[model samples]
Target chain A: MASNAGVAQSRALPGPVRFITSSIGAKVVMAVSGFVLVGFVLVHMIGNLQIFLGPEAINRYGNFLQGLGELLWVFRLGLLAALIAHVASAARLVILNQSARPINYSHNDYVQVKFAARTMPISGIVVLAFIIFHLAHFTGGKVQPELFHFQDELGQHDIYAMVTLGFQNWFISGFYIVANALLALHLSHGVSSMFQTLGVTAPAWRPLTHALGPVIGTIIFIGNVGIPLACSLGLVAIPAGAM
Target chain B: MHLTLHVWRQKSANDKGRLVQYEVDNISSDMSFLEMLDVFNESLIAKGEEPVAFDHDCREGICGACSLVINGIPHGPDEGTTVCQLHMRRFKDGDTIYIEPWRAKAFPVIRDLIVDRTAFDRIQQAGGFITINTGGAPDANALPIAKTEADLAMDAAACIGCGACVAACPNASAMLFVGAKVSQFLHLPQGHPERARRVKAMVEQMDAEGFGNCTNHYECMAACPKEIDVRVIAELNLEFMKAKISGRE
Candidate 1:
């Protein structure tokens, strides 16, 4: 028995390396990367809310971000890495889950699983698509050249004009609203699930962790949609000379 | 009660299975689900037809031998009860019921309604024991255990090894079963000697068995005939993390 134990130990992979290849390890990666992305979304939403402060404040905020130059690229690259890890882990889990049930049941019942949990893969894909479209529209200036490349009087990129004009278009605003709603649905399940996967929620605090998902998701949804809705309704408009 | 059952019929593990319908009349409402199957089997014998094969033992819930996904829900529509304990009264007269085997890649169908659950036995064999010196039985009072801890351990130990959790889970994960076994030992003082090794081995075995990962769907808890809580899965995660971290040192 002692010899066998030694043999097993010698044959086993190193702890950290084995963990990355294990099922739980993949889930942990998903949870951690999900946290990073969630943080980025919240910060981005808060920064966008600065548009309510008018052209100077919002454009200056954009200029400040661009001012960082290489530092900004580093941040973007970090975010890109997180996004790739999150999506890769998610896709792998999906494939494994599908293979787990080789035979399909004619009738299957779900008791405690919610709609958001059931449609996670779909909602995740939708959010990914929205992210790509958003970057192309705002950052790349490829989607709408006329509105995206405008400059304010001070010669900074007119972020305020771009945002207000984009939201004023019903199609852009509607798409933003719909995509944000889907993101909320995805986050509602993802957030609580991450807590469970990380094993941070003890039995005593399980209820709180479960409720955290919807609460955070709702806050983000409202914060993001508020900007677009306000812009479309003429509540927040571009400054007189900023365009 | 007269009922129609669309039972899954398979010749062997290598053969294709199909839902074959059968009619059983005059089933007593007081008859347990297995008893109903017995009556149907007797009718098949009388007709010289091949009777539907299923796994059952003790005709009681404790054995965890009887497994059936009745009407899409594991162990029929009844909660916290196995098929052997589920009475026919739970069904309406002339109702059509769908019955299928526990479906998972780790649990392949051996025959009708019987999957090779030896995968579970292999997982248990990996680390589900303590390597204590052989001796006489210890006194009941030899190890003093707190009531709360003992109760929680017993609760987790109550798992009967039924694969309903796998059938009910969309991901077909076995975290609940593995969690229950790990928690049963983790909460006990006697189980501490090999805690890290046990958790690591069992989890590795579980992964090697081709079971899917848990995504916190909570369906396993709902479908469990023994009502094992998913909180045990959290405990399993904790134990695994501890093992991985401590093993590095």
Candidate 2:
């Protein structure tokens, strides 16, 4: 009996490398990266909320971020990496999810699945597209190069002017509101469900985590949309001749 | 009560199915759902038409042989009830019911309302058991089992492998079934010897069978006839993660 004491092999089983490529593995990737992105969005919204403190606070915050130089690029690259991982894992899972049901049910009456859960892929896709547009419009200044040229009375780069002016346009403000709403919808489901995927949510912890998602989602939505809504309403702006 | 039935009718696996409607009258509320179907099938046979082919066995909820998605919910609308145990009384008069086979790429339709579920059997065969010595039965109560552990094990063991979880899942994932099977053994000492291999093998087999990924909708728990908790799925994930880190242990 001792002849083969340590000889039985895991050769019959999937190895670590293979497990990472499995459905559950792809889920793990998505959850981890989704978490990174979730943290990014929350922090981004909170930082931008400083616009309520008026031009001095938000612009100084922007200047402080810009002064980080290479550190800023590092953070951006890290976010980019997380974005790729999240999207790639999603693409892999979507294909498998689609192919799993070759046939369609005539009546797919779900008992417990909610709207946010059902619309995950679509909401996620829209949010991704919105992220690209947001970066181009705000950071690259390509969409509105005109908004990039303003400076405060102190002659510092006037992010306050750019954002307020950009948001003054109903189209720009409306898009931000709509896109952030979708982002909130995506997070409302993703934030809690990611715990389940990571196997970190105990049965007792489920209710808390599930409730936490929507609350955080609502906060993010309100924080982000509050600025644009204020800007479009002329409550927060660069004034008649502040520049 | 009179009812209208819309059933998916497929001549063969290669045939493209369609919802074919029929009228059923005088269905007794006391009759079980399968009995209602049998009555309809009998009438169809009398008309020289091929009766609908569905799966059922024991007519009691234990065997897990009965499979159906009635009115879009697997095993009908009753919670923790199988189709065979679902009494026709649950429906109202003049109501329209839609019946369809279990839908999945792995579970192909064979005929009217019957799909091949051998995919499940294959998954079970992968590593759903422990090796036992032959010749004589072991002494009863030889191994001391704690109440909590036994309760947990039995809870998972309640799964009858009905595939309703797959029907209810938005992704059509089979994690609940695989979770129940893996957890049933995991809570017992006899299951320890092959723990690593069993988890990995079964999961690999499940993936190869082309089931979808679990996105945590938990509809599987609701549709489950046995009321198997998705906590088993969490255990399955925990075990897989552990196995990955400390393989060959």
Pick by DockQ: which candidate is best? 1
Worst 10 residues of 1 chain B by lDDT: B240-249
- Number of clashes in every candidate structure? 0, 0
Off by over 4 Å in 2: A1-17, A239-241, B135-142
The numbered model that scores best in lDDT is 1
At residue A28, what lDDT does model 1 achieve?
Answer: 83
Lowest-sum lDDT 10-residue window in model 2 chain A:
A1-10
**Native-vs-model 1 lDDT?**
0.89
Lowest summed-lDDT stretch of 10 residues in model 2 chain B?
B240-249
Q: What is the CAPRI rating of model 2's predicted complex? A: acceptable
Model 2: TM-score for chain B: 0.98
Question: What DockQ do you compute for every candidate structure?
Answer: 0.49, 0.43
lDDT of 2 by residue, A1-243 (tens): 111221122234456547667767777888889999999998998899999898999889998999999999999999999999899888888888999998888888899998998888898898888899999998999989998978877777898889988998999899889988988888898898777777762678878888978988899899988999999999997767655
User: Which tens-of-lDDT digit does each residue in B28-143 have in candidate 1?
Assistant: 99999999999999999999999999999987799999999999988988889899999999988999999999999989999999998987888899898878998999999999
lDDT of 1 by residue, A91-158 (tens): 98899999989898987877788999989999999899999999999999887888977888899999
Q: Candidate 2: give the clashing pairs.
A: none
